[model samples]
Each structure stands twice: as C-alpha cells, then as structure tokens.
Target: MSASAAAAETPAATPAREPILSVNNIEVVYDDVILVLRGVSLDVPEGDIVTLLGPNGAGKTTTLKAISGLLRTENGEVTRGEVRFMGENIANMAPEQIVRRGIFQVMEGRRIVEDMTVIENLRLGAYTRKDGAAAVKRDLEMVLDYFPRLRERTGLAGYLSGGEQQMLAIGRAMMARPKLILLDEPSMGLAPLLVKEVFHIVRKLNKELGMTTLLVEQNAKMALGAASYGYIMESGKVVMDGTQADLLDNEDVKEFYLGGGGEHRKSFKNLKSYKRRKRWI
Candidate 1:
C-alpha cells in the first residue's frame, strides 16, 4: 500500500469542546447580606437536558437569575465566579445583551401577559430581532406547529387553558432562536395531565429541535426522568451531582427526595437508631 493510502486510513483524534453554557463557582447574595447561592456550578452542552432538583429555598431560581443578569435588582451579585457562554464571560453583560447572545429564560409562573393576545405576546418575544422577517414568520409557524392549541387560540391568550398558557410561554422563548433556554419550574401549579403535556413539549424541544436546556424543577421524579444529568441542591449548595439513574437509585436520594415506600422510611429510622446506639457504646 502507498504511504498516502496508509495515512488516509488512520483516524485523527480530537479533544471534546467545552460546554455551551458554564456557570463556574457562582455565588449570589440578595439584600447585600442574605446569601442565596454558594459557589453553584453547572454545565449545559448543546442538545442536552440538565435539571436542577431541589426543595424550596434551594437557590435554584436565584441561579437562573444570575445567569440572565436579572439578580441585580434584588441586590444579588455574582460576587465570585463568572458565567461563560460560547467561551465568553457574560456575568457583566446587560440582560438584553444576554438575550441577544442566545440565552433566554422562561421564568417561573409562565409569566405570559394575561391581557395580551397570543400573537401580541409572541411578537413581544421577537422584539429584539431586526431582520429576517420571513425567517421569523416561518419560525412562528413552526412554534404553532409544535403547539397547535396556541395556533387555534392565536387571537386570544386570556381565555386559553393552563396548558395552553405554558405552551405559549415556551413558544415565545423559541421565537428568539435561543441556543440555551433556562426553564424555571415549568410544571409548577399545573394539573398532573397538564404537567405531563408540558414535560412532553420540553422533551420534544430538546430532542427534536436540538435546544439545550437548564431546568429548575421542584418535582424531583419528573425532572430526573426527563434530564440527561441532574444536580441536587440543598440550602444553596449542591449536595449531589450524578446521572439520572444513579440519583434515582441512591438510598439517601430515594429517602429524602423521591419519597420511596414506607419500608425505606423505616430503614432510615433503623439506621439512625443503630448509629445512636453505636455512639452511646
């Protein structure tokens, strides 16, 4: 064989690229004294679902705000580390600039304009865009295609169902063509059926549309099931970080977060008793 043919048969190895979004050692403080996040770090690669799981007051929401530059009003500051997007530090960028940089946040509560028409609300999402009218129109149609209920009610948002409102919120975020979307409790305050629908849409967006997501959810089981990887936070600190299956099978996680069977609770109590007896001895 010729040397050129031999060289052509050899494969070239390349190092993996960094994640699209990186939150490195971020600490947030509100009111100048009330600290919310303590060195929270997370990474979201392209086309993956990363969930932040925690009970209330775990600094999940605050982490999202820090990434979007919306923490300043609450007197919260990064204070320590930086948030990097596409290899650029965005900790000091303005919120508008952050959106332009392809990071969009769908805040808690769905936050859709109650009185505006569905189209109006969607239009507001694209206010940042200047060109590509035809492309924007095509994207809007595509969003409606994913959310057909929104298309049926495109003339009215105030009268839509809870599920429709959630759909609109997500569709609105899509209008901006974001590279990574920060979703804060998309299933909160929804019926079980509606929650399933919302999660289905989230999964579809991540899998079918190739959108990277950072999800903060109180519903631990559902979040872990949908996520590629998960971080469990407690009192502003990450207590565990692992694959979904690892976290699901963890004894401590099942006892505390998953609310496993009564047998699991009894086992925890027995373990505690054993520890106490050993200490006494």
Candidate 2:
C-alpha cells in the first residue's frame, strides 16, 4: 500500500475528555424550611445519555433547577458542593451564563409561549448569541429536520397539539446548539404513540447528533429503554444507580416501579401504613 494511502486510511486519535457536566454532593433547601435536595450528584459525559428516574417530588426537577441556577426563585439555595461544566464551576453562575456555557434545558410542561409563532419562539432561544445569524439559521434547519412537525407549524404555536408542542419545546432548545440538554419529562401527559415518537427523537439525537443528555423521566420503563445509565431517586435521595440492564434486572426495581405482579400492591399497603403512623407522630 502507498504511504499516502495508508495515512489517509489511519483513524484520527479521539481525545479523552472529562464530563461535560458534573454535580457533586449538592444540597438544596427552600425558604430555610424544606429540604428539596439531599446531597445529589451525577455526571453526563459527552455523547452519553444519563437518566434520573423517580416518582413525583423526588427532587428530580429540583436537581435540574439547581444545575440551571433557578433555585433562587423559590428562595432555595445550594448550600453545599459544586456544579462543574467544561471544567468551570457553574454553581454560582447566572442562568444566562450557564446557557452560554452550552447547557440548555427543556423544562417540563412544554413551556412554549402559546401566543407566539413557532418561529418566533425558536428565535428567542438563540438570544444569547450575537454573531450566529448564519449559524442559527443552519441550526434552525437542523432542528426542523429532526422535528418536521415544527416545520409544518412554523406560523402557529398555540394551536398545536400536545405532541407538536413538545416537539417545538425541544426544537427551541436545540436552536441554541447546546452540547448538553436537560430534558424534564418530555413524555408527560401524551398519548402512547406520541410518547414513542418523542423517545424516538431523543434516542436519535443522542446517537446521530452526538449530544449528551440528562433526562428526568417519570416513565421508568421508557426512560430505562432510552438511556445508557440511570439513577433512581426516592424522597430526594438516589437509591439506586446502574446500567439500564442492571436496573431492569433489579428485583427491587421490578417489585416497586416495574410492576411485579401483586407484590407492588402489598408494598403500597405497607407504605400507606407507615405514612399513616408517621403522620400521627
């Protein structure tokens, strides 16, 4: 083989890099009265999908808020530890500054402006960048390519169906060209078919676009299927952390979250009794 041909055939060495986002032993308290998060920590490496799976009020959303610097809204503050993004400490950074550092979030409830056009809403997501007009246009096209429904509803956002609204919410987040995107319940309150569609797009984004994701999901089964790693939280604490397969095979997870025959019913009865006694105390 010719030397030039051999050189062309050789693969370039991929660099070993640290996680794009890292949370270390963070604690959050609200109004000095309630503790919303209890020493939570997680990591999202480049091109990997990590999921936080939990029931309601498990501090899933609170953790995301802390990472995004939105904890101040509820008079809540991170009292311990750090949130590192790209080797920089983001624990005290402003929300806009956090976004500028390539972390974006598609909050729960598909928080799109119902009164605005889809295109206009998408434009607002890129407000942090000043000189990315051409790049933004390209990125918009990329988002449309991923969510064709958004392309069709370019002129209408308020009138869209629930599924389309969710798509637009995700597409708007993509317009920022973030390296890592935090998705909070993208499948909430949707039909089964639409849930499947949203998960399809999510997996495609991680695999094809090389985008790292930290998904907070209530649907444990579906989230496990889409994510490579998972952290299971209960009452503001991470109870289990493992690979998707490990979680699937876990006897405890199957008994509680995955619906293992009549066992969960028995467990629920015990939980109810415990709660009743605690309330009495």
Candidate 3:
C-alpha cells in the first residue's frame, strides 16, 4: 500500500469537548477608572473542576464576580471582551438573570445569612427558581445529605462554627442546582482538617453530581489536587496554565507556588513583585 493510503486508513483522534464556560479576553474596570482584570481568559470544561490560583490582589475574585454579574452591584463593568456560558454571551447580565440561567457563585467568606436559620439560607439560594416548592424541597434534602451536620443545625446560621458556615455556604449553592458553581476561596479560614474535608466533598460533587466547577483558591496544593486543569494569575493576567500534573511538575511552579524552592530562593514577596523568569513572560 502507498504511504498516503496507509495514513488515510488510520483513524483520526477524537476532538476535545467544548468548555461549559469561556472567559474570552475579558477586561474589567471598577468605577470606570480602576482596571482590575487585564485581558483575562480561561475555560471551564463541562463536569470538571478547574482552579484559579494566585496571591492576594491577583484579580481572581473579580473574575468570578464578572461571570456572575455581581460586578454591577459594586460599580464594576466588563469594559471589553466576552464571557460565554453554555455558548451564550452573559457578560454584564443582571446577577439575578445569571442565577436564573444556572450559574451560581458562592462568594468568599461564606456569605451565609447570619440572622436566618440554616434552612432559610439554603432556601434563599432557590429564590430565583421557577420550579415548584416540591422540587426545591427535594434539593434542600439533597443538600442536607451532602452536609449532614447542616441537617442538625436548626438554630441561627450565625451561631455555627467557621467550618459549618462554609458547609452552609456550599449547601446553599447546591440548592440552586446550577450548571456551573464558582467557588472563591472555599478553603479560606478553615482548619487544616476541615479544609481537607471540604475539598473531598468538592471532588464528590464533581464526580457524582457532574457539577462543573471553577474554583479560585490560595491553597495551591489542595486546589491542584482537585482540579483537572489550573490557571495561575499574576498582576491581573494568566501567567501560566496547564493540566494538573504539568503545573505540579513545573520547576517555577514548584518553587514559587508549591513551597518547594530551597533556601537559595528568596521570599515569595520579593520573587512575585520584583522578578519574573523569562519563561514566565
């Protein structure tokens, strides 16, 4: 057989699946003067956990707010580019509309309602649902199943411990039954043990519920472990991105983000602020 014929007989590789969410070169500005995100872009594949990692003030949280349309509430605007969810342009949409369209954001600091009961806070997540009470009730039970401790908390949500409040925050997002859940610093302020438990549940949610997750975390070890892919941001731009293994194995990543660099390396503050390896650029 001829070489051309032999090559033609070989089957082609399967195409990669489309991402459920795409942030395409989005630029966000606060109060029409302060530029926070500069041409940021990322993709969240369906039914997979993708993580965004960076130091404080790297514009990670702002990226999430832009997607969930909470920016308008804070006088922020997406001045350029597009944010597409499920192939629809949703940039600058109202927050409520974004929630109704199956996108929910669990804000940082576990923004559970302090005065209300745990059940009330969870139900508040369903406020945008047109589904009947019975459906909402079923999801409420489902959320409690994931966080059984929440089931036991009948009193005010305010009184719960930090870990329990984090659980409540995640449970509330589950109540929305969203197609995509944006988790900002889910590991923040939790004990080491509690952080492990939370990441375990996050993995479980991805596996069993098939929920597509976009996670922003400072805990690089935990985040990269749970995520299939990761993006590292610096100065409002994605400086590096790769599959979990690729990122975990990179020398710069290991030294700077993973705490693996030896004594010769200076502090992270000096490294981050003053220096950039040529490859990173």
Candidate 4:
C-alpha cells in the first residue's frame, strides 16, 4: 500500500485521560497481623464512576479505608504500594488530611450522628473547608436541594427513615465539595425502590456535578448499571475488571451475580463452591 493510503487506514490514537484517583498494587494489614487486601489496583478517572464488587470479606471496604486513610484508625495499614490522588501519594495520610485533599468517604453504614440535627450532620462534612460560613451555608442549601426530605428532618437525624438517612449521608458528602467520593455500599439495607432512587441520585450527581466516585457494593446489578467501569474482587484480590457492558454481558457474572444462570445451574447451595471459585481464581 502507498504510505499515505496506509496512514489513512490506521486508526487514530485516542489520548488517555489521567485518573483522578489511582490505587496501585496495595496491601493492607490489620493490628500488625491479619493481611487483608492483596495487591488491589484500580483507577477512577475524573468525573467517572467506578465500582468494586464482591461477596462479604472481599476487602472492598478495606480498599476504601486504604484510599481514604481510615485504615490507621482501625490499626490497619497499607504495607505496600501507593494511593495517588491528583498525582500526589496519599497512602497512610491522616483521614482528615485526605479529606482536605478533596477526597471524602461515605462509610458503609449511614454514619450520620444520631444525636445531631440533620443540618448539623451535613455541616460537619465541611469542617475541613477554609471557605467562610457563607460558602458553607450555600452548600448546605445545595444539599437540601438534592435531598429535600432532609429539610423536614430538622430534628435529630436518628428519626429519619433508612432511605432518608442514606440520602443524608450522601448530602453530607456533597457538603464537602470533594473532587472524589469513596462510597461503601450506598444501597445496603434499602428496599428495591430506594435502591433505584439512590442510584438515580448517584448518576445525577456524577452527570450534573461532574463528581467522581469509587463505589464498593454487593448489588452487582445496580452497581454495574451506575458505573462505567467495574472490578470484581474475591478473597482480597481483584479477579475481574472491565467496562459495564463487559461485566453485565459476561456469562459467569450473569449466572452468579444477576441471577440468570443456565438451566443446568441450580441453587448456589447445590453447587460446589470450588466450581465457582475456579472461574475467578
């Protein structure tokens, strides 16, 4: 082929965008023993939603703690590798320091203070902001706009419904004006409808506000629906990583996670666990 013709036939290279958050081959240990996460690595590009999914004890939450620097509080430490946010290594930094650096974690449970009023709980998220009360107050109004139910819940946060409490937790994270959010099971314990609503809000925040998120979730269906990219973990290690469509369309994922197994596959209890383990391991 002619040089010009050959050049024209070649595909153009798509420039790679730098990730807002990068976790590289990190290992975590608890209490100077009990190794947890094993070389888990992933990336969250700016304004993108990524999800980490697995069964219980897959180290999903531990990964979040490792990135958010909460591991130290639990006597857990990132023994190897690095976590970088905006190109700066933040692994093992103080939780407060990580928050100030524009990363906020909405922990697994709705960790809102039951004793405080809903508004007070939201304000607590902005403790690291140097901006004056005016900016904080504006953000407070913005949060209420996102979760209008919080407006009526001026009383103690303890009284809100489970879904409402979940909303409060996210709204509180919004109060931080963070660059990235680490969400650990936002849909946990919610009804189906509430799960739908929460995912809708999550999508809205990502699309409208350009918020970047790294989500750890057990609801594979919902997580895959909301996230552009996904990682599936098993026993503290990432076993699979792919785009949403890739995971949703995968035979193993459809069978195991989405409840669409073949006729030959019966209930999980009837199956040898090793049969499933072999697929990922």
Candidate 5:
C-alpha cells in the first residue's frame, strides 16, 4: 500500500487513560444539616500522586472521608453525587466494604490503636483481605522496609513519636495492598526533615509500586513537588485544578500556598468571593 493509504488505514488512538478513582460532584452533609462539600470533584489516575490542597475547614479531609466511607463514623454522609472506584459507585458502601474493594485511607491525627503493638496495628489493615497469610507476612516486611522506625518500635503504638506515628499510619495503609491510598495531611505536625522524608516515600511508592494516591495536604510546596496533578478546594468546593507545574506557577498559589507572593500575596479570607479567586484558577 502507498504511504498515504497506510496512513488512512491507521486508527487514531485515545490519549487519555481511565482514572482509578473519581469523585463526581459529591455533596457531603453532617448531622443532617451542615452541608460540608459542595459539588467537589477530582480524579486520580492509576499510578499517579494527585494532591488535594486546601486550608483548614476547606472540606479537604471531609472529601477523603467520603471517598473511604469513613464519614458514617462522624455522622457525615454523602448526600448527593457519586464516588466511583474502579468504575463502581461506592458512595453508599460501608467503610470495610470500601477497604475490601482495595481502597485504604490514612486518616489525619494518626488514629493508631494506642494499646496495640506497632506490628499488630498494621496487621489489622490486611484483615479484610482474604489473601493468604504468607502474602500478609510479606507485606508486613515490605511496610517495615518503607518505615524502618516502625520496626524498631514494635512494642506499642502509644510510645511512637508524632513523626513515627505518621509513618506507622502510612505503613498500615500499605499493609492493606490497596489499589488507591487516600492520605490525609501526612505532613501534619511533623518536623521539616521528616516531612520531606514522608513525601519522598509517598513519591517512591507511587513510582515503584505503581500505587495510585490521593494526597490531601496543606503543605502546598511539598505536595505540588510530589504530585503529578493538583486540586485546590475552598469553602466546600474545588475552586481550581491543574497540572503541578500550572499550580506551582500560579500567582495566587505562589503568594498564598507556596509562600512566594511577597507583598502581592493575598489571604484566602479576603478572597472569599469566587470572583476574586478566579484570576489564578
């Protein structure tokens, strides 16, 4: 066949890959009255670290809870829209069901069982999986390799330092062998060096293990550095989203989140109106 004829016979390939996890216009309400999330939506592609950045009370943590089905514990519910994991609508699924479906959430505040040994708390993460005991044992070693400090503090979770606690939280999530990991404020309350180390591990896992991660964080500088894409939420809605480069270069994000705006910086409190925040988004 002629070159032109061969070109005509070739079909165009789709460029976009399907997302592993998607939150579509979800609205979360608490105690039947307080509406927290207002139509927030985002996507996490397989094997990518997608950062969800927002200030306190921006519904960032609430979004993670809704995805992992942890909202029920706090009397919060996704009243509208859908949370789809691997093309399955899981908005109404129980937390354990979500975990069983290969989603694990590393909640904020390091919710480790104080009395349990570090290894014991981690073992609980794999409880929902029917995988063989050997697989669980292997993953335990892998988790420890990722956070060696946990190996040293095998006694009790209560004795771990704040940074060690955060590491244990993430290590526990890894033990579940989750397809998607929802990390809430992993850098919270950690020292600068430890914060960098934590992000390094998160990035490494996403690359080495092909793990899909949705990271909710306030540390914009570090988060963007590790993420492939980012979404900025405010006042219960996703106000902006873009590739990491786009967000890092944004003037408003620089001034406010990345600490680069200098005198040009503006506080989010002053930009309550969407019109004011739209310039950078």
Candidate 6:
C-alpha cells in the first residue's frame, strides 16, 4: 500500500475533554422499596450533546432526576453511587442547590405554570441566578430570538399549544444559563415538523452557546441525530454506548429504535445466532 493510503487508514488521535456532568454507577430507589435505576453510568462532555435513549420504563427520566437532585422531592433517593457536576459531588444536594450549580432539567412534560403568563414563566427560570436586571433582560431577549414564536405569547401558559409549551420549557431552561442541561423527552408530543424544529434548536444551542446537554428521549432516531455520543438503556442498565456512527450502523439499534429496514432472519437458528451477535444489548 502507498504511504499516503496507509496514513489515511491510520485513525487520528482525539484529545479528551472533561465531563461537565457525570453519573457513575448510580442506583435510584423510590419510596425506600421500589428500585428504579440499576448501576447506571454515563458522561456528558463539555460542549457536546450526549443522548440517553431507551424504552418507556428504562429509567431514563429517573437518571435525570437523580442527577438534578429532584429525586428527593418524590420520595426517591440515590441509594448507591455518585452524581458529580463540575467536579463536585451533587448526589445529596437539594434541587434548588443543584439548579444554582449550573445544571437544570427540562422535565418530560412541558411543566409550565398554567396560571402564569409566558414571560412570567421564563423569568421564573432565572430565580437561581444572582444577575442584575440588565443581564436577565439580555438573556430573555436571546431566548425570544431563538424561539421567535414565543415573542408574542404573553398570555397564560395554559393558552399555548403543545408544541409552543415545549418550546417554552426549553427557553425557560436556557434562561438559567445552565452549563449542563438535562433535557428529557423534548420531542414527546409534537408533530413531526415540530420535533425537527426542536432538535434543530437543540443543535443550535450546543453549537452557538457552547452548551453541554444530556438528552433523554424515547425518539432514538431524532436523539441520535443531534447527539455526538449515544447510550442505550434497558431494564435500568446501560446495555450499549458508542458514538453516533457506531450506533447508527448497529443493526439492533436500527431494528429496535430506528425501525427495521431489511429482511428478517430466515430461521429460528438464524435469529438465535443474531441475538448472540448483538452483544451490545
């Protein structure tokens, strides 16, 4: 082989960036008896979007709650392991303390205050910040620019559409200027086009604001598209983790998450053989 061809075949070395958020070997239990997360571990590198993808009951939401210190609110607790953010152990901290530490979670449903106006809802997100009115005003302007549709909706949050509420949830999270955003189910109930638009904004935030995100989504295909790294969870465990290319090329991920695209195995033996081959699960 030619020297140039050999050099091309050799992979380039990558420099490692520090994790903004780390959930290591965590086990979350609720009401002291019901265990939800089992030895879950994942990392969100600075300035990159890392997605946590799984089925409905795979403990994705629980993991986010555990990291953000919201678990304690619902009689949930991190029974084992540690959740560290910006190099500090935050597993035992309160939710408000966690928010003050630059990590905010946009909850699965658009949990805006129904009685409050849209701008009032956005201002609530900055409750943790010690910034002056000028800084808060600037951040509000930035969020409005990102979600132009929100520019006019000063009415009550209950009056907004489902898609608009999702947008408001994200914009509210951004108002905190969080270093790491735990985004849960951003594409939950929106139309296909709206999902596309939300993911577009997600990518834009990462690229423009230098934001780091840990996204939890059942929409694996859409999540993977926005993510640089992906983790697949099942039955409260991380069964597989890899880069976007690694995940997108996996036949199991394609069949299960992205929807199958090719012919099925011909026999039970073939199926059994392929199951064995799917070591990632």
lDDT for every model? 0.80, 0.79, 0.87, 0.86, 0.85, 0.85
State the weakest 10-residue window (summed lDDT) of model 2: 6-15
Number of colliding residue pairs in each model: 0, 0, 0, 0, 1, 0
Candidate 5 C-alpha error for residue 8, in Å: 37
| Candidate 6 local lDDT, residue 99 | 95
User: How close is each model in CA RMSD to the real structure?
Assistant: 9.1, 8.4, 8.2, 7.7, 8.4, 5.6
RMSD of 4: 7.7
Model 3's TM-score against the true structure: 0.90
Better of 3 and 4 by TM-score: 4
Cα displacement (angstroms), candidate 5, residue 133, comes to 0.7
Model 4, span 147-166: residue lDDT tens: 88789877899988889999
If scored against the real structure, what TM-score would every candidate get? 0.87, 0.86, 0.90, 0.90, 0.89, 0.91
Clashing pairs in 3: none
The reply for model 2, stretches above 4 Å from the true place, is: 1-17, 261-281
Candidate 5 segments exceeding 4 Å error: 1-15, 262-281
Q: Weakest 10 consecutive residues, lDDT, candidate 3? A: 6-15
> Lowest-scoring 10 consecutive residues by lDDT in candidate 1?
6-15
Mark the regions of model 3 whose C-alpha exceeds 4 Å error after superposition.
1-15, 261-274, 278-281
Best lDDT among the predictions, by candidate number = 3
TM-score of candidate 4 relative to the true fold: 0.90
Q: Candidate 5 overall Cα lDDT vs. reference?
A: 0.85
Residue-level lDDT of model 1, residues 1-281, one tens digit each, is: 22223223222212153689998988887887888888889887677788898878889999999998878666778888899999999985778999999999998988899889988888778878776789789888898899887877855687888778888999999998889999999998899888878877887787788888899998876777677678888778776788666666776667667676235346657868755653211
Score residue 39 of candidate 2 by CA lDDT. 84
- Per-residue lDDT of model 3, residues 1-281, tens digit only: 22223223222212286888999999999999999999999998888888999888999999999999999999999999999999899999999999999999999999999999999999998898888999999999999989999889889999999999999999999988999999999999999899988988888898789888999999988887788788999878888898776777776777767775454767768665646543332
